[model samples]
Target: MAQTADDAKYLWQKKLDNGHIRIGFNDVAHQEIGEISFAKFPDNLTEVKLGDVILSIEGAKAVSEVHTPVAGKVAKVNVALKDHPEYLESSDEDKNWVVELF
Candidate 1:
């Protein structure tokens, strides 16, 4: 995966080998949100425009939305988050990733 910084604060974009885009939160975002308790993502959402809200995260301090930086079709999501929401607290790239868009 090739990673790039998005213009939006705390958002990172990763380019997958198959030319898809992966969206994730950076450490700064995790710090701002506090401990994450839950995450909600759109179900069966295929197409999305730039800046579309794809996921919502609830933390101890506040709720924040994760938006798409580029227009694309949803390919996959980190379903692990459904059972292990605390994974959002991780700053590790492999753990904090939220979704993949193709």
Candidate 2:
């Protein structure tokens, strides 16, 4: 089947000041997923390969798994999302980002 617009944008990637790669769903995806109610992320420092599942989230619409587009070690994750998943709903890319890959 053809991919939907949201499916085409599986993630938005940005390079941090420290050179880590930050990734998250873009506005298109956020609109599709809605308010995030829950999130599961792999532990920090975990080795991830391209296409590996790095995140799982429950949102207003449906549960989804996010795969990595680049391979690297898990440098950091927005731990704040653990308590306040609504951060994912924000337009602020910094706050919406899920993980930083080394």
Query: Which candidate number maximizes lDDT?
Result: 1
Per-residue error for 68 in candidate 2, Å, reads 0.8
Error of 1 at 6 (Å): 10
Clashing pairs in 1: none
Kindly list the per-residue Cα lDDT of model 2 for residues 3-102, writing each as its tens digit: 2233347578889889999987778777888888997776553888887777778888778777788899888888888888888888898788878898
| Deviating ranges (above 4 Å) for candidate 2 | 1-8, 43-45
Q: Can you write out model 1's per-residue Cα lDDT over 3-92, one digit (the tens) per residue?
A: 232327777899989998988888877777789898888776688998777777778877767778888988888888888888878888
Q: In order, what lDDT does every prediction score?
A: 0.78, 0.78
Per-candidate RMSD, Å: 5.9, 3.6
Clashes of each: 0, 0
What does candidate 2 score on TM?
A: 0.84
